[model samples]
Every structure is written in C-alpha cells, then in structure tokens.
Target: MQARQLTLDVTLPDGSDFDAFHAGANGLALDSLRALARGEGERQLYLYGEPGSGKTHLLQAACHEASLWGRRAAYLPAFLLRQGGAHALEGLDQLDLVCLDGISALVGCVETETGLFNLINASRCRDTRLVLADTHAPRALSAALPDLGSRLVWGPVFQLQPLDDAGKRAVLVERARRRGFDLPGEVGEFLLRTCARDLATLMVQLERLEQASLRDQRRVTLPFARAVLGEGG
Candidate 1:
C-alpha cells in the first residue's frame, strides 16, 4: 500500500511560521497527548490555561504530531464548528484524534452545547481520543450539561500556567533561533522588558523585527530591536 501524504495549512497566530513555535515548557503536555494518540488509558484530555498561556499551541502541536505518525486527526475550533450544527460531528468517528480549540465557547448555547456532548460521546464510542482546549478549567465551564462536565473530569486534565519572565525570554530566544535570526541575549532581554509580556504580543513583535531585519539586511541586534520598537537606538 502506498503511504498517505499529510497536508494542512495550519494557521498560526500572526502568520508566524511553524519553526517559530515554542514548545519548551509544553513537553509534558505533548507527552500526554502522545499517550492519547497511542490509545493508552484516557479517551478525553482537557488542556486549560489562561489567555496567552500556549494552550492553543499545544493543541496544534498535538495535531501536527498525530499527522506525522500517519494517524487521522481533525482539528476544529468549537466556535467555528458550532456554526454548522450537529452535522459537524459526522465522520468524527473515523478519526483517531479530535482536537477542539476554544471549547468554552460552547457554554450556554443549547445547540452547540448539545453538539459538543454528542461529539464527545461519539468519539468515545469509537475509541477516538478527544483533545480539548479551553481558557479555564473544566470545572469552571458554564455549560448546562452535567454529563459533559462530569466526563471532562474523567480524564487527565492539564492546566498550563502562564510562562514566567525567564521562561518567556527563553521561548523568544529559542523561536528566534529556529527562524534563522540570531537574537542577541541583550536584544531578547530588551524586547521582553519593553514589549507586552503576552506570548501573542511577543510573537507579533518578533515578526515585525524579522521583517525590519530583512529590509535592513542586518542581523537582529539590540539596536535593530530598539529601532523597530520605536524606542530609539
């Protein structure tokens, strides 16, 4: 049998390339998802974290990993799939992994609420692993479905705490390395000190710096970061 070639246009926030993804602190989270892919113990995994805490990144990484393993993985943001009604659950049984982002968006709405419940049940019946990402913990979900709430607690739940300043700096430096931009330690520190602490914001700034560096045909330096940031070299 010929091997299947995987293809996807996975969109990263702010048009960042795949190399720019930072998975340093998310190693354990990835391992948990890998266990799910192997059909180990749990059928459901909940990833919870504050905004900008890399939950979505971890979810995307799981999807990417599953594809590399030649497994069928479907990634759907709950908010986007909810627009299609229950039919969205169709063919979900054929997948090995189902990754849902923004799962908390289904709270309160009767149709979406029921749709998510059905998805979970359908995936469970077929032994499919469900990876769900939400802004808050499952116990904090405001959905009206008691069974869904209870089922969420049945599996391994991981809460991703926000990265500390040092962690964030390491992430930035590592990302810069992958992007082929040699960011000096001092420059990385300068950006972290002056720019927003949020990863999303830092990613945006990094992209801007990438462009500015390319335009000037110079390596990323403290002066370049300061100049692009309008901080005046």
Candidate 2:
C-alpha cells in the first residue's frame, strides 16, 4: 500500500532518530535496528518493553534512517489501522524495511493477524527487514492465530530498559537543542522532577515551551520553562 493513499500520518516525526533516542542499556538493540535500516540484518527482530520505553520512537527512527539511504520504508501502527483492516499491510513487503508498532493491538483481528504473518513471510522471501514492537513478550500476547503468536519470538527479542537520570537529562537537552532552546542540566533535572517523566510527554511540553520562548523572546531558563509548563514545570 502506498502511503499516499491513506489519511493517516505515517511519516516519521521530528526528533526521532538514533541521535535523539536515549538507548541507555539498549545499545545493542539500537545497533541491531541500525543494521536493519541498512538492509543488513537478521531479517526479523522483535522488541518488547513497558509503556514509554521508546519502542515506538525506535521503530519510527529506523524507518527514517532507512528512507535516508533511498530504501522504501514504512511505519505502521496497529491502532491507527484498526478500521482499515488487513489492507494496511498490503504492498508493504515491496519496501526495504517495515516497522510495525503496537502489534499487541492486532491480537483480536484475525485478518490483520494473517496479514502480518504474510508480511513476515514476504519479508523473509524478499530479504526485507521487519522490526516489530509490543508492550508484551511473545508468550504474553494471546492471539487467535497460534502460529503468529508462537512465532513472535522466532527472532531475537530485546527488552528495552528505561533511561537513567543522566540519560534522561541528555535526552531533554538534545531535544531542547533541536528546538533551538538551551536546556541546562539543572533545568532539565528540574523538569524531570516536576513534570511527567515520560519522554513522550516531555516532547509535547518541549514543543509548548519552544512556542512560548519564541513568543516572549526568552531563554529556556528554569523559570521560563516552569512558566511555560505551569505547575508541571
């Protein structure tokens, strides 16, 4: 399926790449994904982690990197295609890389499950790399399609670890720099303490702060960031 035919915004978001990802202890997983982006990989990879562990981030990042090298890459989130059914999986194997996010959401959809299995088989046939992510381990996910559920672990499954204090701060600083704002270590720490610690929420807050800083011609100091983010800081 060509991306242009869908209303869904599957394009890689800004600030999603290896440079923006805080790999933390998941450096090996990051390296593996980079290899897949270049069409030099183990053919299939499954990574599962808790919510907000950057699984989706890494998937989109992989797609972005693959596209940079002139390979056709697609980012498909199961939730967004719930109503579209198996049609979303069509023609995806023609791409060099396919990153499927939120695979757990497809457990109940028989058609989608079969479509995903076909996608996996097609990837193997075409030597295209497939990266799939979910919130549960391969065994934890219950699906009507036994073959699909049991085969999720056919490839390596990496459990992504959460970022530590320093890593979180680095992520914040890097994101701020991308938005043309300076985020001092102390201020980054402050935001971490006072706001939602999830990188996804932090990214939303960062966008708000960027707009606020530009409007007021102010630096992203502790007080300014706090004001922009309000009590969340």
Candidate 3:
C-alpha cells in the first residue's frame, strides 16, 4: 500500500496569554520533557491521558519549545506513520526529538509493533529523545510483543488527569481569547453547561461560534451561544 499522507498545520494558539492547561504539571510528563530539553539522561517519556485531556497540547508545546532552542523535533501521529509500513522509521534517526501520538493504534500488528520497538531502540542509540502519547496507560496496552511492552515501560510515564469543571472552563476561555474572539463569561459558562466538556469538542464549538458571531455581526452573548448550539435560547 502507498504511504498515506496525514498533513496537519501545526501552530501555537494565539493571544498573549501563556496560561497552559498543564501549568501545574510537575509530574513525569513535564519533568521528562524538561529533562530532554536540558540534555539530561532519560530521554524517553511516555504520557497517558484520556481523549481531550491535553496530552497532544503538551507534546506540541514541547516541539515548539525545541524549535526555539534550535533543536530538530519531529511530531508524528503513530496511526499515520504505521500506515506507511516499516520504511517510515528510516529517516527518523536524523531527528533530535521524536514525538509519537495515538500510539495505541500500533498495539496489535506485529510489523508496526516491531517497527516502533526498533525506532525506540534506534532513537536511544542515537541519543534522540522519544516521547510517546497514548489514550490508555502503557501497562494496559494489549500488544502481542513482550519486548515491546517492556520497552514502553522503560520510559518515565505520566498520567494526565481530566480537567475539572473549572479547569475546562478556563481552557475554553483561554482558547477563545487566543483565537481572537472575545468570549463573554456568561457565554463561556453556557457552553460548558450545554456542550461537550472535552477540549476537542469545545474547540470545534468555538470555531462554530466564531463563524456565527461574525456572520451575525454580534458579540458572543449567552443567547447567541445557546441559539447557535441549538439549545433554544
């Protein structure tokens, strides 16, 4: 099969705000990334979080920071890379940092599983930092390869807890501000009250809200939010 191309335009969230959803993160996730940034030992890190728990955000931020430090970092979603067959691992050795997201997708297949194992080994041998993100915990992955499971456990693992109601609201407000939309407090609260609480869903809702507000030439009010969300204002 031909290599399936998955291209996503990666950019930092806008606004002058630096408030991160992971601001309080001093656990394995933050520490491991910091270690890699500081050129310390333990170059491999594993991050586990539920969907929309900000795992991808932290990984992307790390990549952005690495770029500022003039280091080479490659972020690839594991699902896409695995679809390209084993040859995908060839050029990754050239990177200073490699981030793999959605790694659970590679669990069952022998070829992809072994390929990831080899990639991890190659990265270690080359002194490249490897970061892996998965929806489930590392020990819970049902991979058939015993060695692969062992390799995953070799890294420092962090579990990203789901954001509380306040945390989710803060994220929604910050994201809206970053996107150049003035989200009123009432509107933000309304969204959290009625829409999906996950970051991914909130992001999509914000994009829709932005379009609706622009088309109607009105600021984002609670009524507008509710009406646009089909919640019957």
| lDDT comparing candidate 2 with the true structure | 0.81
120-231: candidate 2 lDDT, tens digit per residue: 8888888878898988888887778868865677678999998887888888888888877788776777778887888777777777878888899888787887777777
- Cα lDDT tens digits, model 1, 1-233, are 11011113334343232334554566676677767766665688899888898777766666666766788776776555655455555666667887778877777777767777887887788888898888889988877866878767667888877878888888888877777887788887887778877998887788899999989898888877877886632
What tens-digit string does per-residue lDDT give for candidate 3 at 1-233?
11112212334454311235444443556666766754576788888888987777777766766766788776776555666655655567567777778888777888878888998888889888888898888889988876898899777888888777777777778777766788888877777777877878887888899999889998888877878887722
Among residues 3 or more apart in sequence or in different chains, the pairs in candidate 3 whose N, CA or C atoms overlap within 3 Å are: none
- Candidate that would win on TM-score: 2
Distance (Å) between predicted and true CA of 52, model 3?
0.8
Which window of ten consecutive residues has the lowest lDDT sum in model 2?
1-10
Candidate ranking under lDDT, highest first, comes to 2, 3, 1
How high is each candidate's TM-score? Answer: 0.86, 0.92, 0.85
Shift in Å, residue 94, candidate 1: 1.9
In the predicted model 1, the residue pairs found to clash are: none
Candidate 1 C-alpha error for residue 2, in Å: 25
- Where is the poorest 10-residue window by lDDT in model 3? 1-10
| lDDT, residue 157, model 3 | 87
* lDDT agreement with native, every candidate: 0.72, 0.81, 0.73
